[model samples]
Target: MDYTAQILKNPIFKIVGEAADEMQVETYVIGGFVRDILLKRPSKDIDFVCVGSGIALAKTVASRLGNARVNVFKNFGTAMISYKDWELEFVGARRESYRKESRKPIVEDGTLEDDQNRRDFTINALAIGLSKHNFGKLIDSFDGLKDLKRKTLRTPLDPDVTFSDDPLRMMRAIRFATQLHFDIEPDTFDGIVKNADRIKIVSKERIADELNKIILADKPSYGFKLLFHSGLLKLIFPEMVDLHGVDIIDGKGHKDNFYHTLQVLDNTADRSKYLWLRWAAILHDIAKPATKRFDKKAGWTFHGHEDKGARMVPKIFRKLKLPLNDKMDYVQKLVRLHLRPIALVKENITDTAIRRLLFEAGDDIEDLMKLCKADVTSKNDVKVKKYLSNFKKVEKKMREVEEKDRVRNFQPPITGDEIIEAFNLRPGRVIGEIKEEIKEAILEGKIRNDKQEAWNYMLEVAQKKGVELN
Candidate 1:
């Protein structure tokens, strides 16, 4: 199929074509740009490969445009030019060979066919000629159009060689499948399983980047299951793998936390597009394996797993190379409080309970509720209905309590400094005690969230503590 009409509409391609003609070199719009054009996916980044000096061609193009800036990476022999909202990358056609110890490829200038042969997947190997003589011509040496039509993922070369050369491609394979909702060709999948161990050589940061992409897919669970089955998950993220399997003692078996976590992830994905909230769902029950216990009456118990999981979030983020900023703290807080809303659902919830949840969860209370609701993955339809109905009630109660108390992310009406000044005391444990008491009084609904009432309560507490109140 000809994409000439569609591509010609964009003046950038014509400018590049003119620049290539001036340089008297063969150039083609290749890789993801070609793939996405055929798939009708919106793409802003454009890649072009030429048989001549890509750096020199980039400089010519930038000079011709007169407005775009060329960013050159001399080490990699690639240059990029930004035009409007689009990024155009130029690279000389080159062949690559890898050593067993690293994925960094030894590069040597070669023909366009050699460059296409080195592509990670067939679908990405398609190219569109960008010269006056062959402008808009489709070049598909590996029948990439067929794979695109079949919605299949396969390497242009041997899958074993492709994955072994760069095991990160295994993650890329699954990531592409997940993003495009395609299936990995069986042989390609087998390569992933065989070379799963090679993923260890890749940096944790790279693995984390791929994992985040998978997590952001339309149905993240599909990618995760593929990761688990391919054994890649075991090598890259053993903590999640440990959540697999079910152990039974005396006819009692808890649900597989691994699959359950995936379900929660999908559920959260459906509710919100926030990546960190989805992360919270994945880690909500992470400590189940560590906290697992059996009792004759209780059947199975994961006591304090939420607390343990919260504490584990930072360590896991540090290991996985995820951002340890507010995003990590957000995930940790959700993991810790995931059970609080459910507890309210299962019991006779009070305003005090809702207030504490709001205060602790702060502005994240909505996300926490979404996580708790997703956690209710029961096979019994009736049980699921009951839990959902109870959750609605809890939500209603939270709204009412929030409207009246205004306790979400609320600071105590009385400050520690005020308490110290009133009591004529230095910074001491007594000041902190008074602040806690004031916050508790507001949360417990024993006093209005007003400065006068809080000041009076502070004085009363000091009197009770046998300190003279000014």
Candidate 2:
């Protein structure tokens, strides 16, 4: 089928075709942009493959398009041009053969068919002709259009060969399935299962990238289930895989932390698009396996799982090559405090408790509440309703307290520096002790989280301490 009209709608398409014709290189728009076009998904990144020097074609195209700058990568024989909203990448069509030791391929100039053959999946191999004579003509030598119609993903060549050549393809298979909400062809998925260990040859950064895409899906659990069954999760993340099974003792069993984690992840994803919040859900109960114990009287208990899970975050992030900065910290904080609000539900709630939650949670109180609420993945509707209702009350109390006390992320109005000046004392443990006392007083509702009140309270405490102003 020809999409000539669609091709003509964007002037950049015509410019690219004319530039390719002038350079005398056969060119076609291929890979994701083509697939997304057919899927009616909006894409601003376009990959164009040409038979000859793609750099020359890109330079010519850029020159015609307001003398735009073309960024050329001589090592890869590729060029990129940013044209308005679209990022245009041009690469020469080439065939590749992989070495056993590495996923990097040996490249040689080849025809369009060769380039299409190298594509990871059938849907991604679809291409559209860009030259004047064959403008917008669809190319689907591997039945990519058929797979698209079936809403299934399959390897363009032999599935084993496709995945073995580039183990990252295994992760991409699951990522695509999750992102597109499509199914993997049975044979193709089996290939993933068989070649799952080969994913170790791929870098952690690449695997983490694909994992993040899966986590961001509308339903992340689907991707995780695929990863688990394929055995890829074990190879890539055994810590998470360890959460798989329920252990039984004395005729009692705990929930499968693996599937429970996935449920919470999906629940969090449904509420917000924040990737780290979903990650918080994943790790919130990660240490349950390590902390699991049977009390016989009280059934199964995962004591200190939250604290252990919070400690586990840095190692997991480091192993996965995830950012070790504030994003990791955010996930860690949420994991540690996930049960705090729920703990409040069963106990007698007080201003001190609310103030502590508000103070510890700070700006993330709402996100923490969301993760905690998502934590209640119960089969019983009444149980779920009760948990959610209690969470709502906790949220209400937090809001009211925040408005009244202005204590979300609030520091004690008294500062150590001020205390040092007030008492004419050196910076030491005494100052640290005083600051803690002030913060504690505010959090305990003895003071109103106000400067004057904290100052008055600090003076009283300092007087009791027998500190002399020098």
Candidate 3:
């Protein structure tokens, strides 16, 4: 098929074709750039495969395009050019062979067909010609266009061989399936299941990168289900795997936390496109397995799951090689407070409770509310409606409380320095105690979060503590 019109729209393809003609090497635009073009998805990264030296082709193209900087990787026989907003990568058509012990491939220059054979999936193997004679002619030897139209993910070659060559393809398969809303061909999916253990050879950084893409997809639950069924989830994240199954004790059963968590993740994805909020949904009930217990009367209970799950966030982040930063802390905080708003549903919600939640969640209160709402994965429409309705009331109370008390991210109106100086005392436990009392009062709605109110309350407490003013 000719994509000449579409290919010609980008001036770079012409420059590359001219450069390839000058260098007398066959060059073509291949891989994701072509796939996305046909799918009508926007893409800025373009990969070019040439029969000869890709670095030389890149340099020739760069020189013609006002001599843009060409970053060359000698060992990999590849080069990259940054022109305007586009990233143009040049690589020689090469075939790869991997050893059993590592994912790093043994590489040697080959033809365009050899390069296509090495691609992870059929849709990605599609290429468009950029040479003078064959300009815009597609080279789809694997029927990738048919697979794309069918919304099916399939390996270019034998699924086993394609996966065994590089196990990271397993994650990429699921990631692409999730991103494109496609299904993995049965054989291709079975290949992932068969070679699931091979994923261990891939580094955590690459795995985490793929996982993040899946999480940020329109529906992350699908990718996670694929991962769980393929047995990759257990290998990469055993703790989450432990959340699976229903433990029935004497006709009492708890929900399947693993699937519930997936629902929460999907719910959060619909509400917000933020990654960390989705992470919060994933970990909110992580400790349920650890904290699970049963009583004859009360049935199953994960009593301290929230608090325990909060502590598990850092450890999970470390194990997954995720950044141990404020992002992790944000997820942890949401996990800890997920149940607070729900608890308010059963009773007359108070302004003091709202104040405390606002103070603790700070600017993340909205995100926390989102995670909490997503946590409602009940199949019972009535129950879900009741819980969500109560949340709206809670949010309304929070706004009223915040406007009245100004308590979000609450700061102490009375400083410890003021207390110590007023009491004519040095820095000691008494100063800290005095400050704590004032903070508690502000959060409890006993004080207005006002300087004068806090000052008056501080003096009254100091007098009661038998600490006379100087």
What lDDT score belongs to each candidate, Candidate 1 first? 0.92, 0.91, 0.93
- Models sorted by lDDT, best on top: 3, 1, 2
Model 1: per-residue Cα lDDT at residue 101: 96
lDDT per residue for candidate 3 within 1-470, as digits (tens), equals 44547755888898999999998999999999899988889999999999999999999999999989999999999999999999999999998998999989999989999999999999999988889999978889999999999999999999999898899999999999999999999999999999999999899989999999999999999999999999999999999899999999999999999999999999999999998998999999999999999999999999989999999999999999999999999999999999998887756777877888899999999999999899888889999999899999888888888888998978899888888789999999989999999999988878888999999999999999999988
TM-score of 1: 0.97
| TM-score between model 3 and native | 0.97
Which pairs in model 1 have colliding backbones? none
lDDT of 2 by residue, 200-286 (tens): 889899999999999999999999999999999999999999999878887798888898899999889988999999999989999
Which pairs of residues collide in model 2?
none
Over 4 Å off, model 2: 2-4
What lDDT does candidate 3 reach at residue 392?
A: 92
The Cα error of candidate 1 at residue 205, in Å, is 0.6
TM-score of each: 0.97, 0.98, 0.97
Tens-place lDDT per residue, model 1, 301-351, is 999999999999999999999999999999999999998888888567889
